[model samples]
Target: MRLLVTGGCGFIGTNFIYLMQERHPDWKIVNLDKLTYAGNRKNLLAIENNADANYSFIHGDICDKTLVTNIIEEYQIEAVVNFAAESHVDRSINDPAPFLTTNIQGAQNLMECARQAGLEKFVHVSTDEVYGTLAKNEPAFTEDNPLIPNSPYSASKAGADLMARAYFETYNFPISITRCSNNYGPYQFPEKLIPLMYTKAVAGEQLPIYGDGSNIRDWIYVDDHCTGVELTLLKGQPGRAYNFGGAAEKTNLELVRELLSILGKDESSITFVKDRPGHDQRYAMDFTVAQNELGFSPSVTFAEGIRKTIQWYQDNELWLEEVKSGSYRDFMAEWYGER
Candidate 1:
């Protein structure tokens, strides 16, 4: 059961690796990551020296079509689980070029490689941002929701989602796309809202709340999201999209205030900031298909997840500090503790 798992060093990817290792120790998993700003080898250190012979990590870019094909052929990879992407909305707003090249071209590279390889499952991990914002009282985004991505980050993902459909319709290649809500968990880069607030709150800094902090979103725990992805690959119908959501709705300000309460902090830490241009007002998901079809639903409550996440950040202050301070810039040399 050898599989290709891209972006395995990123936050959700890291947690998914740990889950897979626990569930299927006999399965050989190939982890490919580019070690981008958000990718950190330290996140995978716990699995590095394991004697289970179930894992290996490769430093490579997903946009390299030749390299991607070579690895798939060399490994005889049976399935492709794509978690690679330029995911930060803020970063996308700042520089859309990298997001476009990596998200769109990189996905094309993988799809062609998988189509040629005849992989059984080509699962593309995506986000609900593709559906854009919803009007008040509008039905939550289901699998049937139209693609209306606003930001460069979401536009790139939406582009890949369509291409995946093209491959499935044109050549009948097995493909599955999973659009899940915002994810929060351990090892998340502090650039994200939850982790950023956690880091700042701990350091006596003000937390930036954007646009009156009224933007609403459904938050899912990273582990629960992994479960949905795993189930979708094995039990889901091919050529279909699934929406995995926590169904726990909260405004940005509400979420931040909850975090402050959980951390025993006060609201004084929050400071209103200039809102991001074209920021989606709200996002919600209806996971009916994921629930009834794949029997998948979010297992962790948002509150429980947020509390655990806050604790994780507190415990892993050293790693968070390195990432925030750019100390991970020396990863190439000190990757495996080679000082």
Candidate 2:
């Protein structure tokens, strides 16, 4: 099974690539990553060093139509799984142009190329953020929920999701969309909540919390998300959308406290800060379709996943240092500078 996996260097994509390489020894995998601030080639050093490995990496953006088409044709890509995008909500709020370009335009380009190539399946990895916020008492988001994205990051994703749906409706394209919840696992860039808090708390630095720390999010381990995506590709119906979630819901404050507990740190490291505009109050997913059809369910509990994640960060301090230096410093300063 030859496949083109875009954004294979990012957090979730990195994990997905590792899972695929380890499980499908005979499958030829081609990874295309722009290697943006969040993407690190070092994440796949083990696989890259394996002489017998059937994985290749391409450093390029998904918006390049010529490059996308050439790689698909050259590799005889049987499937396309898109994981590339500017995903940080804060970054999107600061600048929305990159998000629109990469998330929407990139998706369109890849889908067009895939259609032309007649790929067997095209799985578009998405996020539950496209459903917007839910009230505290509201139920989790389902596959049939309306797209009411509240952030630039999510709006771009929603646009891409709609585009995928449109392709299926207009051209009978074999496309499946899977919207997953917040993912936390090894090699996750420190910009996100879990990694950011873990790094800060470990260094005795202040762990920033936004908007009274009441925002709730459903968390999923990266491996589980990858499995869900894989299952969706293998068994999911075309023109259908699925939701993958950990069923673990926690507020910002709660998650921070859990991290502090795991790290043996106290609340002294906590600091409340200003919330960004269009911040959603809550997000949860009801992945019944993925569960019933794809036989997908999260295996890692929140506590277990958090413990493993914290240890990964602790053991990979060198990686943290490298990624946190240079442009990452500038990004942090730009986002948290005023706070």
Identify the candidate with maximal TM-score: 2
Candidate 2, residues 1-339: lDDT per residue as tens digits?
Answer: 999999999998899998988889898989999999989998998999999999999999999999999999899999989999999999898899999999999999999999998887999999999999999999899988899999999999999999999999999999999999999999999999999998888888998999899999999989999999999888989999999999999999999998898788889989999987889999999988888898999999999999999889889999999999958889899789887
Candidate 2, superposed: residue stretches over 4 Å from native: none
TM-score each candidate. 0.95, 0.99
Q: Note the Cα lDDT for every prediction shown.
A: 0.88, 0.93
Runs with alpha carbons beyond 4 Å of true place in candidate 1: 327-339
Residue 316 displacement (Å), model 2: 0.5
Give a tens-digit lDDT track for model 1, residues 1-339.
888999999999999999999998877899999999989988988898886658889999999988899999988899889998888887787679999888988998999989888888889999999998997689999888899999999999999999989988998889999999999999998778898788788889878888799999989999999999899888877789999999898999999999988889999988887888898988999999999999997999997899899888888889887887774334422421231
The residue pairs found clashing in candidate 2 are: none
- The candidate that wins on lDDT is 2
